[model samples]
Target: MASIKTFINDDFLLENKYAQELYHTYAKDQPIIDYHNHLPPNEISDDRVFGNMTKVWINGDHYKWRAMRTLGIKEKFITGDGSDKEKFMHWAKTVPYTMRNPLYHWTHLELARYFDIYDLLNENSAEKIYAETADKLGSQAYSCQNLLRKANVEVVCTTEDPTDSLEHHQAIAKKDLDFKVSTAFRPDKAIFISHDGYNDYIDALAKASGQEINTYGELCEALENRIAYFDKNGCKLCDHGLDKMYFESYTESEILAIFAKKRSGKELTGEETSKFQSAILLFLSETYHNYGWVQQFHLGALRNNNARMHRLLGPDTGWDSIGDFPQAEKLSAFLNTLDSKDKLVKTIIYNLNPADNEVMASMIGNFNDGSIKGKVQFGSGWWFLDQKDGMTKQMNALSNMGLISCFIGMLTDSRSFLSFPRHEYFRRVLCNLFGAEIQNGQLPNDMEWVGKIIQDISYHNAKEYFNF
Candidate 1:
């Protein structure tokens, strides 16, 4: 908000001279380590190109889709069968409404960074802007691999299910691309034993692991085999998405009986479901520890709120919101269990609800034990809380309650290729925080040390954290 002449010039988010210097010098040119994202490895392997802007930019982009729907746009122009240009036009028309939202800045930043078009997109500029981007995207040079290279990304870990073949990841590894593309084991389908088609998913898991799951121990063995396979294929991280951390008490015998009943087509009661989930999650976390892999827990998301729309569209289509769950107690117990067994691997806890910022920042300290630098990380602002206010709150909390210096920084946690600018957005916000403190004399005037810290957070820490 401090007077800036250009919309997205060199000093876009950097307000003061100190902020400007920190961003331009320390953070700007650092290669990105997108430790977590949803980019399709197949596209990276095949170097897929798009025919138009809508295909790569808007399609499957729930962020833009939600904004378009909010502007009273019809479904036909959104996820419906409307033409690509029609969808792009609807999004262009919706851009101005997103003025104060992060989308406004992101839209212009992407346009500037990717296409070098500085014109504000709206009804008048939509046609020209769309055409210009369409031509660039249609070219072979703008394929998925080239797009990632353009972003200066060093490594990106895409999330995958247990039943995944990892074929695309295998092919990408064979290419020996300049940037490293890796996968994270996401075994949500195996953990959520109470959800619909749980047994069917287990059947698929059995097929993938080449094992028949008739008992609880066998299921764990199947998951263990897949973990070994993923580990062999260069996977370095694992991720989980849960409404809250589960830590219910139950014996192995009870859990076995519960799974047996479920496999026999009987539904588990609430207690049984909790116990089963807690058991499998503990098993997975311990296994991750054995493999020397970093683990991530994305908690507090309340997904699929609209049933009618869910029936039409399905999950992860912008229907998720923050869940106000009782976090600390169960999360602490779960981690403590692993830590007590000396089985807690490097962990990153991402809270969707900003209210838990301080809770998570302080919670990581309980089990850090000095075994690793920032061993238990309070992760970056995620999902619903990825904006400026949210990111600032998270960083400030981490700085206050924990050491922000050792932190592994921002990740897109996104599905789009252009979303890499979000890392830029986070770096600017981080520099602004450190730079502002320097301006006010809260921190030393030493630019060298401050710049070092900024560079570490920007790239070095993640590089070392994952050892990539």
Candidate 2:
């Protein structure tokens, strides 16, 4: 028998009796409502199938690419130039080195759940597992639609740019599939002035909205037009990817001056850039309030850190890192600025740094009144923190500081369909946390209440929060 087959029959979860009881009592059949993700809306609409397993899992996933790079695999094996087989082998070589990293767990879990293969991936088993999984990719069970069905996803929201055609989203909506699929408006390209193509993006926005981009007022009008278009097509959420919340107050005059400088084909200073960004954020927040949409801020990510690699492979190709900054003060000021004016929308704050987990979790409590218990939420463990230890820390902190009953659950933050297994990983961790509390006498063994709590965190909270 193969080592993987031996591990499969051995019942890994059964070794921990507490995990078994919790899995049976709390986590078996909960529906999944993924409120946030990076899945392409068009693929879901088309019910697309991958050309191969490597294409589906390795092509666009920077997470795996980063791990392969860390293991001294050449860039060719990652984002550079390499055949699918070569890249898969490079990943296989790195698997044994992953050891205690969450990547090891996620990779094995995906293999077992999807392929029904139980072998540990290493240099020895890599070729066999890859060939076997690749062969299975030709079957109907490995189709993209089947993957979502297997994961039991009830709803999925994909992040989309303002300039997107959304033809795929339209196709999916028209099909009326069992699961609800929608788009989240992500406008980082339009707002981030430091990007190389800021001027080009202005042209794109102008074309999309049929408005001439001459001044600041015109720019705002173009954005508003795009937002309306997005809303008409089933967008109820706006997502902002920023290093931190911008709270610097600026006057209309200041913004007009900055736009004039840019319109003249000149760059603004750092101070001017901050002011312009803050003003745009405020304008967007006001729009979110007007549309009654949920606003999500993915903060604390220091993107494009490695300039050499960034220039070599472009952005999001594993050049980003966790930022070290005091988010609470600025984030609080920004939220309060909106809250005081009664213009705050349904808000979720996700942090990258674990040290700020408690701070961000507790900060939500300061803004929550009796009006809505869970209106302001600390989102699921994000980016670098999307792992077993990170999820556990977030859950424990949120439960300790605020009402975990109202907490929304896991999101993949992934571009791959194979990432759906993440929901299962999160469920197991959640059950273990609650079960341990019960076993230790921290709480009474009321399976009903515990089950309800598990169900709410797993699915209900996200469904209600996103109003899906």
Candidate 3:
């Protein structure tokens, strides 16, 4: 027998017996409601088959690419210019270095669940696993549609650009597929003008909305038009990615002046830029409130700092890092800005820094008026924290600070179908926590109550929250 097979049989879910039982009860039949992800609508529309495991798993996942780079693997092995087989080989070489990272667990879980192969990926087993996975890829069961079905995904909401046609989304909606996938309205490109391509983006927005872009008023109108389009297509959520919340206010004249300067091809000072962005966020938030849509903010990421790598490889090529801002105070002020005006929409705050987990968790409670106990939620562990320790910390913090029963569960936040395993990971962690409490007599061993809580977090919470 293979050494990997021995490890799987001896230790898989056995490390926590209560967890094993909980998984059997809650996880196996749960329907996945992925409320946030980066899956392209076109692929889902096509119901495509991945050419191989490498393309499905590695092609666009910056997380794996970052790890590969950290291991001194050449760019060719990453997004650059390598063959699929070569990239897989490089990833195989880097697997041992993952060690205690969540990536290690995620990789092994994927191997066991999908391919039913228990080989630890290393130089020795890399070729064998690769060939075996490739062989399976030739079957219809391994197509992207089949992969999603096998994961038991009931719905997925893909993050989309403001300028997107959403033709692919419409196409998928027309299909007979079981999963009800849709798009979330993401308008960060229109909001962030500090980047080099602001002018180009403004032009694109004008074309998309069929409105002039000479003034701030016109810009707001154009945005409203796009938002309306998204709403018409069953969009009930809006997503924003920012370093932190902006609560600063600006006079109409000040914002209009900044717009004029930009329209005239003149650069605004940093203060002016901040005012413009802050004003735009306020406008957009109010729009969300009017539509009764949930607004999601993925905060505290410092993106594109590596100018050299960014220039060479383009954006989202792993040039981003975490930012250390006093997120709690600013974030509170931002929410309060809306709350005070009675214009706050349903909101979820996701933070990148783990140290701020407790603070972020508690911050959500401050805004929860008796209207909804968990209405303002601290979203699942996101980005860099999408692993075991991170998920555990998030769940513990939310449980300690607020009612975990109201919590919406895990989302992939991934660009790959293989990432549905993330839901499985979250389920295992959740069950372990509940099981431990029961075993330690922290809670009565009423399996029925505990099982309901588990199922609620796993599926029911998201279902009710997102209204999917």
Global lDDT of each candidate: 0.92, 0.84, 0.86
Query: Model 1: residues >4 Å from true position, as ranges?
Result: 1-5
What are the per-model numbers of colliding residue pairs? 0, 2, 0
- In lDDT terms, which candidate is top? 1
Q: Clashing residue pairs, candidate 3?
A: none
Candidate 2: the clashing residue pairs are 4-118, 4-119
What TM-score goes with each of the models? 0.98, 0.96, 0.96
Q: What would the per-residue lDDT of candidate 2 be over residues 1-468, giving only the tens digit for each residue?
A: 246565434234333455556666666677778778898776776667775667888888888888888878899888777898888888888888887788888888888888887888887887888889888786777777788888888888899988887788878878857888888999998788766779889899899889898899998999999899989999999899999887787889999999888877797888888888888898899998999999999999999989898888888899898998779888898889889989988899998999999999999998887676599999989989988889989998999999998988888988988888788888887887877778788877887777888888888888787889
lDDT of prediction 2: 0.84
Candidate 1 vs candidate 3: the TM-score winner is 1
lDDT per residue, candidate 3, 1-468, as tens digits?
Answer: 245776545335434666667778766579999999999888788877786777988888888888999989889889877889999999988888998888888888888878888878999888888898998887878987898888889999999988888888888878888778888999998887676789889999999998888889999999999999999888899999999887666899999998888878888888888888889999999998988899999998989998898889888888898888778777888888989999988899998988888999899998999785478999999988888788889989999998888889899999998899889888887888878877878978887787888899999988988888
Rate residue 283 of model 3 by lDDT.
92
Global fold similarity of model 2 (TM-score): 0.96
1-468 in candidate 1: lDDT tens per residue? 122127889888898989988999999999999999998888888899987888888888888888988999999998999999999999999998998889998998888888888888898889998888988999988999888989999898999998899999999888868989999999999999999999999999999999899899999999999999999999989999999999999998999999999999998899999999999999999999999999999999999999999989998887888899999999999999999999999999999898899999999999889978889999999986898989999999999999999989999998899899999999999999988999999999899999999999999999998999
Over 4 Å off in model 3, which ranges? 6-15
